[model samples]
Structures are given as C-alpha cells and as structure tokens.
Target: MTKYSSEFKVKLVNEYFDGQISILGLSKKYGMPSKSPIYRWVHEAEANGLNYLITKKSHKEYSQDFKLSVIEYHKLHEISRLDTAIYFKISPSQVNSWIYRYNHYGVIGLRRRPRGRRPLMAKKKKKQTRLNPTKEEKYKQEILDLKAKLHDAEMDRDILKALKTLRENDPNSKKQN
Candidate 1:
C-alpha cells in the first residue's frame, strides 16, 4: 500500500490524541488499509511530541476557485496549449481540451471529462513489411547471375578448344606453325 503524507498522518494522530476518534475510526476516516500505522503515529507523537508528527505542509484549495484560476490563466495570458502544459506540467492535449472548454462555456470547460481514444502506438502491434529486398533474396539473385556467367565462360572455352584442334589439323595451320 502507498504511504500517507507525514502531515496527514500527524493530523490523524493529533485527532486521536485529542480523544475525539478511535483507532478503528481514524483508520476508516483516512482510508488506511492497516490500523498499525495509525497506532505507530500516535505512539510516536506521544514519545516525540507533536513536532515530530507535523513534518510537512499540505495544500488547501477551493475547487471552484482552482477551476476559475485555470481558466483565467489560459484566457488572460493567451498562452498556447503547449506553453500552458509546460507551465502546469501537464500534457499539451489536456491544456488544449481545457482551452476548448473555456472558450465554449467559460470556467465549466476547465472541468475534466472522460478521456477519448488512446494513442495509436498503445494499440495492437502491426505487421510491418520490408521496403527493400532482404539479404537472402539478394544473395540468391547474385548466385543465379554468377551461374549464368559461368555457363557462358564454359561455352567460350569449348569453342576456343574446338577452333585450336581444327587449326592444328589444317595444312594452312602448318604454314603459320
């Protein structure tokens, strides 16, 4: 299971320390799967004091105001979807959709909707074909061409041998010899 923030754990511990809630109740309240961590938090708080429990600060937000700010930031600044994403550390497509919503219906457009289709690469693998002939095919064609050249060479050799025998047998061949 994921660990809770120290501030949140400390707050729960504080609440338990005040005797306002039970261990089981605190576990259920924080949606913690185990009650042991809560017990540990309370014991640690008692032994080390509240300062040990309050290790970090958490954000407080009003959802409506957050949405309005998002809309205003996009509109007033005239920021591109990609630029807004870089500023917010979100995807450009998310910023694009938010801008589309703000343009159509004001602050209501910034509210997150169900995502559409996933990316093309996320789907099944495609069977790709080679654009050029493979090494094996090229080798086979080269062997075929070599065989044709060898046959022609052998034919030339046989023709030259037959001419030599005929010239040697002729009376005119003796005059040159």
Candidate 2:
C-alpha cells in the first residue's frame, strides 16, 4: 500500500470541508483512480483526530494470544484505539483492524499465518527475550491493573455517597433538585 503524508491528507480533507470542490472533482484533480480513497482519508481524519494513519511498515510478528489479549483488554476497559495502540506499541489503525477482524472472524482471525515459503526449521529461540512476557508475569500485571481500576471505582462510589449525604443535609440543594 502507498503511504501518503499526514499533511497531504489533512490538506485534502480541509479542501473537502472548505467546499471548494466535490469529492469526485478532488479525486480527478489529484490523479486518484477513484473518489473513495479521499473520502476514506477524510473520514479517518475526522474519526481518529487526524494525521496518523497507516505509517511506515516493517515485518513484525505477534503471537495469537497476544493479539487476542490486546483486543480483550480493549473490550474490558473500553479504551480508545489510539491509547490501545500506544500501550501495545502498534499503530491505531492496526488496532482498529484487529477489532474489525475479531468481530468478523473471532479468535481464529488473530492467528499468524505465514504468507510464503516456510523455513526448513524453526529459528532457534532466544533466552530471556525482552519482548515475550511470561504467562505468570502477564497474569500478575493484569491483576494489578484490575485492582487499580477497582480502587478507582470504589473511590468514585465513596465520593458519590458523600455527595448524596451532603445534598440531603443541604436544604438549598434539595430545592435545586
């Protein structure tokens, strides 16, 4: 896929919004084969806070479990794709695509499939690689994250309780309600 500069996308999107030309006209003016790419770019800019789309690509492999875990984390926390992508060290668009794939294909969609010729033998595994967190460590980290979330929820509940008490005690607040 051809990578377009973020500035180029924003310029076209601004032009589209400026009402200077129709979508079809913009496409033709830019030597685009169709209007859809421009439309897609503008839509993405609006949706994702602009600029960052698919950036430079380099080959990287993620484990199926890791992919599913990232999606699961997203579903559980309801975090934004941009945040999730940052936490996962991937592009936001990639996380968005994963969500789409998971919705359509389930867990099977996340499994890594090699595109072409296979190696004669699997590459020798490295010891204590920085990338792979052990299962126990992952579980512990998840537990800690959940605990923090729970603490925040409890604090919110306490604050709400205090506010309710205060409102009940205040004759002025009751009148406002």
Candidate 3:
C-alpha cells in the first residue's frame, strides 16, 4: 500500500550490502509489513552494480543453438536463473523467458525474432494519413496514446476507490452500531 522512493530503497539496499543490517532487520527497523521488497531491492542493486562497469550492448540477438545450450546447461545443473545468466552473459529475465518458451513451444520458440517496433503494427494497411510522417512522429503518437490509456486507467482506479469508501461508510445494510 505504501511506495518508497528509489533513493530510499537504494539507501536501504546499500546499508544491507555494507553489512550495517540484514533484510529482515531493515524491514523490522522500518516497520515494513514484509521483508521481500527489501530483498528484491538488494538483488536489483547488486545486479545494477555488476552491470555498471560493463559496456555490453543491450538486446543482442542469440542463435537458437546458443539458447538451447543455455537452457540445457541450466536444466542439467539445476542452476538458478541468475547463475545461468551470469554464465551466458545475458540478462536473467531473458534466460528465463527463453527457457519458458522452449518448455512450452520447443526449439521453435528459441529462434530469434525481430526486436523494436515493427514497421506495420496497425490492423489496417491504410495509406499514410500525413505526407510522409517521420519515424519520430509515429513514436510520439504511440507515446501519447499510451499516456491517454494510463490516464484513463488511473481514473478508473480512483473511481473504484471512491466506491469502496462509500460502501464502507454506508449504514443500515449490515450490523448496526
């Protein structure tokens, strides 16, 4: 129910890393309902620290053979996602996703796919509306659409919250005072 700033989360994770306190200790000290978030933050901070020095390019394509090998190695040794990713020089989430795909869809799932925006995303292949709109304009329009959707979702959330409050405050429907 409560959201802490990134700075605050990083501060606590750093303290844990510095041996000033444990995850449970930090959670208890801060009166948090659970220690899981602190643990997650610590892991995230560690991962970021590990990647800080590397100049590795993001979103590199991997061969099907390499993906299969990574998945096989992971299963053969029963290694954690983080450990497998460390061994293969890929992000942990990517390794997990590839494994999930392979498990559900077999080898075909591991085949590389195009990354980034597809040239044709719209359902209709209508002619260009504007006179050769730039790629930046297309991206900006997508961003604006997403923002509007987010705004609408937030309004729905607020309306639901208000309704819940009204229900809680309603009288003569259940136990009387």
> Per-residue lDDT of 101-165 in model 1, one digit per residue for the tens?
55565444343444678676757676885235356535544554565567678889999999999
Task: Give all TM-scores, in the order shown.
Answer: 0.29, 0.40, 0.47
Worst 10 residues of 2 by lDDT: 128-137
- Candidate ranking (lDDT, best to worst): 2, 3, 1
- Tens-place lDDT per residue, model 2, 70-131, is 88778667787766776676766779988897676555556577699977786886475434
Off by over 4 Å in 3: 1-13, 27-57, 115-177
Estimate the lDDT of model 1: 0.62
Against the true structure, what is every candidate's RMSD?
Answer: 30.1, 9.2, 16.7
Candidate 2 local Cα displacement, residue 67, angstroms: 5.6
Per-residue lDDT tens digits for candidate 3, residues 1-177, read 227765677678778878978899999999999997777566655765633323344647788668867876786666787767766666677888998986765565666676788776778888765244356535544554565567678889999999888888888555866
Q: After superposition, how far is residue 76 of candidate 1 from its true place, in Å?
A: 68
- lDDT of predicted model 2: 0.72
- Model 2 clash pairs are none
